[model samples]
Target chain A: MDLLAGIFTDYTLRNVALGAALLGLVGGVLGSFATLRRQSLLGDVLAHAALPGICLAFLLTGTKAPLILLLGAGLAGWLASLLMLAILRSTRLPEDSTLGVILSGFFGFGIGLLTFIQHSGDSDQAGLDKFIFGQAATVVGEDVLTMAVLGGVALLLVGLLYKEFKLLTFDPAFASSLGLPVRGLGTLLTSLTVIAVMIGLQTVGVVLMAAMLIAPAAAARQWTNRLSTMVWLSAAFGVLSGVLGAVISATRENLPTGPLVVLTASLITLFSLLLAPERGLVWDWRRTRNNRRRIRLERLLLDAHVLYNHAELTPESLAQRRRAAPARAKEELEELAARGWVTGRGERWELTEQGHAEAHRLEQAMRVLPKALNPRAEGGAGGAA
Target chain B: MSSDFVIVLTAIFVSTASALLGSFLVLRRMALMADAISHAVLPGIVLAFWVSGGERATAPALLGAAAAGLLTVTLVEWLTRTGRIKNDAAIGLVFPALFSLGVLAVSLYFRNVHLDLDAVLYGEIAYAPFNTLEAFGLNLGPESLWIMGGLTLVNLLFVLLFYKELKLSTFDAGLAAALGFLPAVLHYALMSLVSLTAVGAFQSVGAILIVAFLIIPPATAYLLTQRLPVMIALAVLVGAVSSVLGYVLAILLDASIAGMMATVAGLLFGLAWLFSPVGGVLTARNRRERQRREFAARLLLAHLAHHDRPVPAREVLEEFGWSPAFLAQAQQWAQREGLLAGDPNGLRLTARGAALAGERP
Candidate 1:
């Protein structure tokens, strides 16, 4: 309870939560475009390649200011993306391989440079290594301010060009024919992604920042089909997960904030995958079951109609015709009778006029289904099946 | 042997083993999976050690790591099979969770142990020479050398014995299955081989940049060559050179050997990307230019063959709207080939040029 109270009133906790939330919002908005384009791993590549930039920033500036470091990291990440695009255009190697090579190559160089700095006897190069997995607990007021200002600008850009980006994501060739600079817009979008990743690097680190960028967007994808809804939902989910992760970590003695936030986002993804209304697994399973029942009921009605048109039909004969058990046939007859489609079900069953009409429609549908399926069997031979 | 010799030899073996396994992985388009498997094997190593009553160096840990590799592949395949996520996203999801689990375990349960995270990231190859192998009371250089040598041998044998199967499965799994060959088996075997190599190389290159040795050398070779055998050979050569050069650079700068090696590998890949002779960017453009010039020359010769009247060179350029450079190069090439003779203001096709233009493929 005190933790909850601290979340509302505590200065440090509030700042950390706000910073995390700001990053989450922008990451979520950008990740929708990324996930839709099947370029989710671009986040991972950019984050890993930013390590060298961070080290370079500190080495040159001799200061560990968050904004300066992020500027360096963002520029490095942008350069990596450009190099990646060049390799793809120039070579036949797939994007995945190019991403892996740049990620490790740049990161390895960063580590080498960092080790040199450590050995150079600079005492203040202490917390620079935390970019590996992030340490969100170390976030301060100035850091939050930096994140909000940068992230706000990015979000505003996304809002201003939402329709253009939407067209760009769905169809690039069409956008190009309409006189849009497809490649330039693509580079701009990539630059925005780099900025968003840079904003979250200090709090989430390199390894898990990829998760933050992807998981929220992926989770929101399950509940939506429209691009606008997806972007907003993703941003909402990202903020909630970030703030909750921060507050929860604050409760523990020494739990890592970054991974915990990622874990929370991941849990949200798992739930959305299984529980969302339209695309969720639970909904799909229920839909399939209902469809099965409807199909079986129609089959029983058609079989009963063919057995003995206007006369009463015995359940045993109906079962024989259906190749099903007698008890199962009797229950199906009872269900039809209960629904007023048939009447007087027992050892014998009689079809109502509605039931007879339904059976005829189903019989006609079954006859046309084969002809529709086999286009070669068009014309008067539709009933041959 | 001197310690420096042992260090370089160990590095060579490590690079060769990884580069060989990585060749198949890269060709199969599973380069990032090596990175995932490398990270995912951490918990497997830790569990194997903890389960075997604190036995530091043994076979169970290796077995556990191999199991982890197979498990990583299985889980990734399973996740992708669910049809909810993509292959890269599935890879992104699985590795970090497992790697983070491994990290949390180290911090929670094994804090008192010597499994430092730094060693996991940047391996201390400097101490590898000190851990000498002992057999029959005679020292056998670094233990890493023997392990990596055996690994390279195993990989070589696997490639030699199953060369046909690997090739067929990699190129066309459906056809392999139609011919009663099990592509899945070869895939699992390759995964196990990659896992074992990754575990063995960990002491030399650490977990992070194993992807570098696994990818960069083979990728560079891929850019330079088209044949698989030659590609593999070139990858091994690249790896060896990168190892030797990186060792020298690292010794000079007193930096991590693995990092320097990775940087060197990246540099080599960059060079191959820019300057490979076979269909590389630089060469491909040049080839296109040459083909265009030859084609223009043929067109000019054919044009001359159609007319007995003297035609001004200026007319050809104005008629075709060809670039001045292209027209001049075409005329010069035709003249040199004896296809066309240039007069003061016009060109004419010779008898040979007429005969050549008369023939059609």
Candidate 2:
């Protein structure tokens, strides 16, 4: 308890926690759209694409202000997206390939610029390196305020455009038919994603922001069917993971905040994949096991009913005729007796009044031959022999 | 000028490799795999650096990047085959995890090391002149050029050797499977080539430029042509041109050469997207205009046919509110197409014209 108290009191811990929470809120809300559109990988591409923008911004203005860098990042990120779209539309190349090309190319350029900036030896470039892997500890009060405003704006935008986003995501053709201006709506959504990724860039950095965007929404998908519920749940999971990761990272020195946050989100996704009620592995396993058990019981009952068709056969004779193990045959007979479908006197067992009705029902259910178990026919055959 | 020539040559070599591989990637719809491979290979690079103990080492780094690239493809394939997750989700899950691992490895092992993430993301293409290789008594400064050249040759050979197989498999993978050819093997081979190209290109242009090279040129080529062979050829040309122009632009502005190159590639795609004669922005707009004109002409022709009168041109103009010039142009087109006949009295549909209108209805 004391150790926990000591860990929580640190200024770095507070800042990281606040920053991650904000990033989580934004990522979760935006990621729902990405997942729905089946463009989840776009998040990864955009995150990497932001690097060149940051490098360029710093190189041009020689300013390390977060706002300036972010604006530059946003512009570059947007351009990358445009290029991706252009490639897909103009070429016979698939959308994924186009995306791949833009993502790597832009990111590579960013890295080159960043390396140049580093080698130039500018003192003001102090915290600029943090954007690569992210340093939650570096989040100042002003940065937190910025995150809040940006996160709040993102949520508000999503709320305002919720209906259009849904229509556009589910069926663009239908949305267009309804005169909803699908292209405009698509641009709006992409813009929102870009903003969300940019906001996350401060805490998770470019390397791991995509994971934060995708993992929480993926995790939330397992828990619910409704879009609204999924969105809210994803938001909650994102915030929870972010806070948890921050706290974990705070407990130690030298642990990068981005990986911790990603790890936490990944854990939530892993949990959802394994344990969500309707679609989880455990539930599926239980369902299959129960189905197999039911099939086995039904098969045993059909066999027992066939035996009962022979006139008052002794338990021993019935077991021997079926070539059944005595103990196993006795268990089946006991189960039938417990259900009042059979009665026993000493070692002999026979179908009772209710038992006979059930036995006939079993025959009808199994569609087996009724005369196959007739003792009189068997006796006549034996006498002829 | 010599530097510009080299840059252009480099672009041609890289684009040739990227375009050849990109054709299959586009057909398979695994274009994002190339992106994933590029990012996920960082660890391999870091590992290569770590194994060689510095950035000066090239062979180990290349080997490491290749290994990482292969691992990424294998992992993605495994996750998809497990049926536990969707393909996009699988890609989303794998690359970041690996990337994060790479980042973490770099930070943990090389805390005091001079290397930074910037170097990993952006390579020093301007400084690429410093690195040279001697092959069979020939001096090739900028070893990346040779590496990319070798990979391009290998890619060309592979594609030529398996052209028929690749075409059949890409167009109809199920049929290919039924015919006893291994589509999965072809897919893996394509992925391997993408990885090799990405890693080879990464040194000179950095990761982002490599990506731009892989996607933009092919996309531009795709807009201009429908045939795969033609697309590949055109894409290579576009890539080479962009690289040359971008290098010049970079020199003029003193900007990052790779970034400028990517920008040029983007510009090319944008232009192609708008101006390509085959289903581009202009084409689509023209198609719409043509349809509107056809509709207006058909409406006028139908009105005349229904009335069985010498309909006044003024009356048709009043009903449609179209420009006189447009109406005249439409009439001329209709007449040329044999959809209408005109005498001094008025315009009427021929039997053929009536049949054409009726068929649409």
On TM-score, the candidate that comes out on top is 1
CA RMSD (A), model 2 = 8.8
Q: Please tell me what DockQ candidate 2 reaches.
A: 0.27
lDDT of 2 by residue, A250-275 (tens): 66666777888887888788788778
| DockQ for each numbered candidate | 0.43, 0.27
**TM-score (chain A only) for the predictions, listed in order:** 0.84, 0.80
Could you give candidate 1's per-residue lDDT for residues A148-221 as a string of tens digits?
A: 88998999999999999999999999999999999999999999999889988987888778777788888898
Q: List where candidate 1 sits over 4 angstroms from the true fold.
A: A9-11, A282-385, B53-57, B112-115, B125-141, B286-361
Clash statistics: count for each candidate: 0, 15
Residue-wise C-alpha lDDT for candidate 1, range B1-361, written one tens digit per residue: 6767877787788888888888888888898899888877777777676687665664777787778877888988976786777888777767766666666566556655322455567765321211232321114346667878899899989988998999899888899999988999999999999988887776555776678888889999999989989998999999999889887887787777778888888888898988899867788888888899899999888887788786887888887899878899988888788888767758888788889988895
